[model samples]
Target: MRAINAIRMGGVDVLPLVEGGKGVSISNGLSAGNWALAGGVGTFSAVNADSFDVNGRAIPQVYHGRTRRERHEELVSYAIQGALTQARRAWEVTGGKGRIHANILWEMGAAERIITEVLEQAKGLIHGITCGAGMPYRLSDIAARFNVYYYPIISSARAFNALWKRAYSKTAELLGGVVYEDPWLAGGHNGLSNGEDPLRPEDPLPRVMALRKVMRDFGLHETPIIMAGGVWCLEEWESWIDNPDLGPVAFQFGTRPLLTQESPIGNAWKQRLLTLKEGDVFLNRFSPTGFYSSAVSNGFLAELRERSERQVAFTTETIGEHVAEYGVGPRKRIVYLTYADRERALAWERQGFTDALRTPDSTLIFVTPEKAREILEDQTACMGCLSSCRFSNWAQHEPDYTNGKKADPRSFCIQKTLQDIAHESDEPAAVERNLMFSGHNAYRFGKDPFYSSGFIPTVKQLMERLLTGR
Candidate 1:
């Protein structure tokens, strides 16, 4: 195999490798800093990252606000402080070597404010900004204001073209790269559009080529296209390296780094990765952001599946074949359901799923009394983490501050579950009970010989191994 060479990215020559950012402090200063230390671009997630106190201990992000809007303010403040700290740490670790990029979900609450504040406070520390999870049209403007490069993560060439023509064209100089995150292979909040079939994943090579062509049409020929998701080894992607048709290219690893020593995930999460089989990672639409995500097929996902399965359409007034009267909630509000559906609901009730919660689509999902209470409590404690959440119906707009829809019980509170999974300890079931986002190729962890006997590598060691085309 040919030796891997450094590529110019964000105005710096670093190995054509990037650590895909994980949120809720999953990818933090320590991990991203070490990744930069290894001569690769390190991307630390600014989405509610953890801030440390003077004693070097993480400060718990507790909300003391009375309303969701108030708590949203607190969340934004916390995120800015955390992002600044992570940027500083990553810059320090580079030692005048690689580059550090801050990643943020555009759908995150007050994303523009948080990124602007972090960049204003930590100027010269962060070299670039990587943003996705939404259109993120304002990202280039923000990066240009800060004199930093911006990388927009998109799954399709058409999406990139739309962004380039609309907003990115203005700040074309600051556009560092375009990240092509495969919707099917990537973990956590996939970009699968309405036209694409989730079950039928298309080849990433063709998709990336199409993206490169669009970039070329926009006169962005040299901008590297970062191929993210399902990129485990460099050997498998040798054809993508130095390919003339694709132009400058880089590989992003979202799952392989979870077992590294610098990774912040718990030991149980790492152990679970090693035991996963080929089909263990499941792709489902359970996120409050209304985006499809990939996660481990654990107890948490199973419960969500069961909840959606026990659903039935209903109406308050009589309609065709909807004459079966059913009472829901403590008030016993009567709704009409189909006779066959009523029997199914009754059967679910016999199995202890007696609480029927209404969804935004006029459907009711049955759950146990305890489960219903927990769900309500979780919704009540909403901090407005996302700009628009289906679970809590929390929208970050003026006046009503709601999504103008009924709070859907089918989707769980993402803020609560993500925070719990990222930092939870001592609880034995936390790993299996919270969302464990992983790429479709996460099962390779069990088969990879380099990780035999559970030998986790440091970020530097992982970089070295990757450079060897393994």
Candidate 2:
């Protein structure tokens, strides 16, 4: 018999383990379906998940557009189709065994429209919706309308309380448990605010207890708090289970599950995780969307790190002050800069970092010509998907950018690299250039005896080990 400690989520007695939704194809139908098949919760990322191809093979389109609105519409349509298809796939894989959920980022321009259309269409297939990357204030209303459970992925108790007071309280019936994704350690975008210190890592138990307190105060004492991010072995979490303060807790693994046999990440990516060491992941605000993200320390991340490290406070005095040019066009102009910076850049260029890529509307600097050519090719082969990309400011009309500013190459086109890392044939280049997400405990993969058999466990195997103690 299943353990009596099972938590109820979305009206289903679900194993607390959730396959945290990863964007850009990290968590897809196959991975989520297997999670649900194991009687745990599965959440497929619907942020422009691959829909289909002419031959019906799933193909993700991250940057296929000539205009902002066009990219936005494609993202919506693709999400709707992908969500439905993935949910149905999960149902098929699990034989109707476990609960299936969909994950959506709240910051997308058409986040509301895409999500509503997806849940409305998926109907009985999708049991719940999990939203994060921003406080999803409208999540309650949207989920309630579809008669589906809604879970807001939050980092702190304060954020949850604020949401409950304003919107979620009225729809308490469908308010699914809150997901406590660790802000400092988790891969992808973090939720840490400006005042939050990343250096001093705090224990999650107290924070979860605080969340439980909020639940009790809001008449939701029974609501489970799904703990995410750095969670690893269940044995380590035994103290949390049935604890008076935490009450009805469940652990969600974001990085641990990636090593499972059933996880859909590319083999090269998996191998990279096994070899990753401490201090290899970095959190930086390099994204054009102005979000802080975590990525593995690879050649790509190293280059960005070097650039950020070598940054000099530059100023322009004349047109020739910082003169650098790329393609000849109406928008072409040399970026002005200080004499000292110009000399420093020239010296660096002589040191073999010769290629210079242009920020969409800003100035041009040096990159290896090869990297520049690759960036240009990738941009030219664009499939507009983001609302507006900083790499290619190819908007539908005159003003292609959102802030009405030019695109910035300092921030690489995120959609392009993520798509490459997820599915491209160039495995090494993908790992080298794109960011790879993993948990803080990812090193355990190399140290754990359980994985010593040269075989990774499947989702079902991992869950069984966790719940049944191997």
Candidate 3:
């Protein structure tokens, strides 16, 4: 393997391997700091990261607000403080050595506010900002205001072109890098556009070359393109390095870092990664943010799949082939379904899915009475985590503060599940019941000899391993 060399990113020379940021305290200061200490870019997630008390113990994010709006405000406050705390920790670990970037989701509730406050408070501690999950046109402006670099995470060349033409061109100097996150294989929320098919995985080389071409068109030839998603080892990506067509490129490891010693995920969650198979990580489109996401095919996902499977389309007015009347909810509101669908619904009800819940897509999904109650409770308890949520129909801004759509039963509250999975004690049951995000290459953990006997490497050790191309 060719020797790994330091590359310039965020106006600093460092190893091209960047630590990908995970959310809900999974990628905390320890992991980010250690990665930075290893002479690589360290990114701590600002998406609802945890803040600690005086003794450094994590304070539980228990919401006492009476209204969803009030809870949302509290959440934003928590997010800002948490980001600051993590930034400080990362800076401390780095000792003014490596680059530190804060990662945020553009669609997250009060995203602009959180990032603005974090940059204002963090100052020189954070060197860059990496954002994705939406077209964050305003990201460059915020980063420029703070005198930090901005890395916009995108899956296609068109996304970068749109960003460059709109807001990024103005702050071209501080445009640190562009993160090319593979939509079909990347973990967590994906940027899969309507034109793309999730079932068909495309080669990263062609797409990245296209992105490089677009970047060059905007006079961004020198800016590094951070390759993220499905990146396990440097050996497989040897050809990508020093490839003139792609220009300066860096590798971002999202899933591999989860098994590291400093990763903040619970032990049960870490252990589960070692036993995964090729098809265990599923690219699903069930996010409340209305974006495609990749997660483990665990019990939580299985339940969602089952609920969606029990769904039947309905119409208010009877049309051809949709003439069967069905009563939904306690009020017995009438909706028309097909004869075959009615029979399917009856069969599901007989199988203990007695309650029928209406979705935003003019569909009714059958679920257990207990599950129906749980879904309502989760929706009622929504604190507007996302800018707009399909599960609870909660929108952060404007007149009514609602998306003006019926709550979809097929999706669940992401904030609640992430916090649950991240903070829960080392218990397999709790870990399995919540969302577990992973890249498609997570199966490599079991197959790789480096992870034999479930040996979790430190960030420095992993860097050493990557350097040897093992």
| Candidate number of the best lDDT | 3
Q: Please provide, for model 3 over 228-313, each residue's C-alpha lDDT reduced to its tens digit, 9 standing for 90 to 100.
A: 99898888999999989989999999999999888888899988999999999998989999999999999999999999999999
Residue 411, model 1: Cα distance from true site in angstroms: 0.4
Clashes of each: 0, 17, 0
| CA lDDT, candidate 2, residue 132 | 89
Model 2 lDDT, full chain set: 0.73
> In model 1, where do residues sit more than 4 Å from their true spots?
425-427
Residue 86 CA error for candidate 1 (Å)?
A: 1.3
Model 1, global lDDT:
0.91
- Encode model 1's per-residue lDDT on 270-297: one tens digit a residue: 8888999999989999899999999999
lDDT of 1 at 293: 95
| Candidate 2 weakest lDDT stretch, 10 residues | 324-333
CA lDDT of every candidate? 0.91, 0.73, 0.92
lDDT of 2 by residue, 1-470 (tens): 23526678778787777888988667777788898887788888887677777897776555456655566567667777877778777878877776888988886556788889887777887888999888789999999899999999998999999999989999999988899988877878888877788777788878878888888999998888898887767776776777777777777777877777777677778777777777777777776556677777778777766654434333233454444322212354344556676566677678775654445434445666666666667556544444345555544334533445554556666766776787752376677777676666777777777777556888888877778632
